[model samples]
Target: MTNNQPAPDGVLRLINGYWATGVIGAASAHSLFTHLENGADTAAKLAARAEISERGTQTLLDGLVGVGLVQLHEGRYRNGPEASAYLVEGKPASLTSFAQLKLKHMGGLVALPDVVRAGGPVTDPTTEVADNPHWEEVVPAIAAQSVPAATLAAEVLGLAGAGPISILDVGGGSGIYSAVWLEANPQARATQLDWAPINAIARRLLVERGVADRFTSVDGDFHTTDFGTAQYDVALYSHIAHQEGPENNIAVLARLRQALRPGGALVICDYVVDDDRGGPAFPLIFAAEMLLKSKQGGTWRRCDYHDWLLKAGFEDVSFHSAPPATLVVAR
Candidate 1:
């Protein structure tokens, strides 16, 4: 143990990463966290509660313990702090639906080889936007996932002081960004442009948050929508840029810039890679996910964004570090 040596830990973890993802998905699918929270500490009890065989329950519980999602004390199992907080059903920040969505994506990853061989996505990513039955679950799940980052983005953008702002949320999925800002700035109003299905969910979310009066939904594809000129004080593209190629992104940014008022801000919140397009592991790995999913979308570098924003007529561009992604703010 004292002797220093290179380890193959990284390689092994990479190879077996799917195992962890599968385990988490399975547990979330079965509401294991909820069962644990309800005091099903023994495998036999958990199995009874979950309607699964005792043997299978024990096996899954052991795997959860191994992954630190569950804790073992004596002969009892319990939800770990992370699981208790974010995986338990009915929790405000629960990510169970998000985990389920990931499970669906994991199933699609089997076609990655075909995508690579064909040099394109095997399935149309646009279909998800056109007729996604999962929107009811997905919108809320994504909003839950984005809450912290949205809060931070609002703070960083000084939404509180922006004063009677008119905002446009381009391709806003859950409308979480606008919702957060509106809550922070009572006088701020937002217009969310997205697909009809997603707009339905955004409407529900805004109504539920009791901010529907301050927000309006424009149901259409962002690529074709005429974002009316020079009216909005701020335009936001949260987690949308990675879904387009350079030319398309530039076009979209230019449209957004046109939508903003003179001296207005354009906020791009996405997973931005380094200039070399390597490292900062999330965006790099996310690029592979994009390859497997989108026809022409992947993470972009900060330089790429800077060039695009400048070309779109945005000045005084800056990048800020945000959890799970980077935030590029321009005016």
Candidate 2:
């Protein structure tokens, strides 16, 4: 053995200890960080509340403290600043919904090993999430979860042009994209389409946001439903394409094209891989998860959207960079 620890990559090879994800997952699952949502507690109290053995909880908390997700002081543990903001439930800027999404998908880590051996699409354990009644019930929370991203999309739509606009939001879970845009531009209205659970949530969210009067909800599967043709001034596809794959995306674009009035616009938001096939890290990692969970989805290239848009009968596609993903605007 040539002392592999110090192998050619030097510090780079040693620094990539693989247990980071597991440690974080363990911390989250145990609610070690979020349990401190109300206040700090001793390990004994936390373990009791979480219904785990105290010794195990203490050990896990120690690891979190080392990893900076938690802080240990005197004889108690608390969420660190970063965790407090994003991990705690009911916080103003909570990302716990996305974190839960991550946790729900963490089974992919183990599933990936089998996926590599089989060499094709892996069976998604989460496919049924779309069918769950709870999915409809939680759509508002999910839509609310998308507020930060939608706020940006709303700004883009505001800058595009002037009119009393009608927007069609396809696969509009949580209706964040439309809701945010409507909030920013009071003259704009939206038609939101998705599974019923999500539509239910979108209904309430639009009401709460004061746009329900202008909002219309269509609840059904996207594949068979009619998304009104030659009707709207703008259509939005946000984070929906990568879940279905290229062929479906092309078909969707074509359908939406028919839905747009002459010279109307289509806006797509998705992670774009560099044409050179290098790293953005987020899209690549997400592509791996798509392999494990989706049938036709992956992070695609920038050209893919442009080409697909053109092939689907759109012209003058424009691309803009948003962190971790790109916005594609076409007419």
Candidate 3:
């Protein structure tokens, strides 16, 4: 042991990383952020309103402040800017459900070693687990998580005021992209293809967003469902490429290409690693999650997407940074 250098600060933070997730999730479940937003600033008041123990409330508040999700001022605690926006229960952009849903995934991660040993999950989540299906929860939660990526893709593609364009969102979990785009461009309409149950959820959410009248749901698996030819001005395959093997993605991309209008674009959003497979921490780490959850699922390189999209009959492919995700546009 050297006197000058003693502790492994970064390593320790990584080791105890679940603390951050646990505390934040617990706070969200307790409605702590919503309570703070509603002006229950003091520990006692928050505890009373949230039905938490006073000491428990104080400790949780302190943890939230430590994690930068809450701010402390003059012995009072309140939500930080992000918590104020996305952790509150009733907001459209709220990730409260997502946070709670991730708490369910944490326990499953304990089997990562077993999953790796077996070369994948003993039973893959991608295969549709009837005993413990997560996609129902996963779809909606993912919509909140995808707000930034979806919104960014819309802007990058000039969806706003792109008059009367039709969108085909294959595997469009919560139909968030459609909702976001339709809201931005009134003349736009969307068709979402997903499982019957998932499409129902998307339909309900779209109804809540007041855009269901212009949205259509096609209830079936994207792999088997017919995407139709040259029907859509824009085709979206977001956050799904990572869940598939190269061949599967390529096949789907080819179908997406055929579905687009003559001069239309196909937009793909995913966690794409650089060709060299170097760094960009989150996507690389996310590969491990995919590894444990599905067979043949992992983060792919830029070259992989380029090759796959081109092989799928797309002439030009370009990548764009959308923060925490990347977008590939093919035309």
State each model's C-alpha RMSD to the native.
2.8, 4.5, 2.0
Q: On residues 1-331, what C-alpha lDDT tens digit does candidate 1 reach at each position?
A: 2468768887887888887787788888888899999999999898999998889888888888988899999998999999998899887568887887776777777888899898788766665565878777667777777777678778877899988989999888888887788999999999999898898888888887888999999999888989999999989898888988999999999988988888888888899999997768888888887887788889999999999999988878998887568989999
On lDDT, the candidate that comes out on top is 3
Better of 1 and 3 by lDDT: 3
User: What digit string (tens of lDDT, one per residue) describes model 2 on residues 1-331?
Assistant: 2655545554653354334455566666666667776664788888887888989887877767866878777877788898887667666456555544454555547777777666545564554465676574345444434555566665666633455888899988877777678867778789988887778877887787788888988878788899877999889898888888788989999999999999888988877787766867777777886677666678898878888999999978987767567788889
Q: What lDDT score is found at residue 92 in candidate 2?
A: 43
Q: Is candidate 2 or candidate 3 better by TM-score?
A: 3
Looking at candidate 2, the ten consecutive residues that score lowest on lDDT are 12-21
Shift in Å, residue 164, candidate 2: 2.7
Q: lDDT (CA) for every model shown?
A: 0.86, 0.74, 0.87
Ranking by TM-score: 3, 1, 2
Off by over 4 Å in 3: 1-6, 124-133
Top TM-score model: 3
* Residue lDDT tens for model 3, 1-331: 5978867987887888888888888888899999999999999999999998999989888888877899998888878888988999888679988888777778878888888888887873654532335667777887887778788888888999699999999989888989998898999999999888788889988998889999999988899899999999999999889989999999999999999999899999999898898967789999988878778879999999999988999998889987678989989
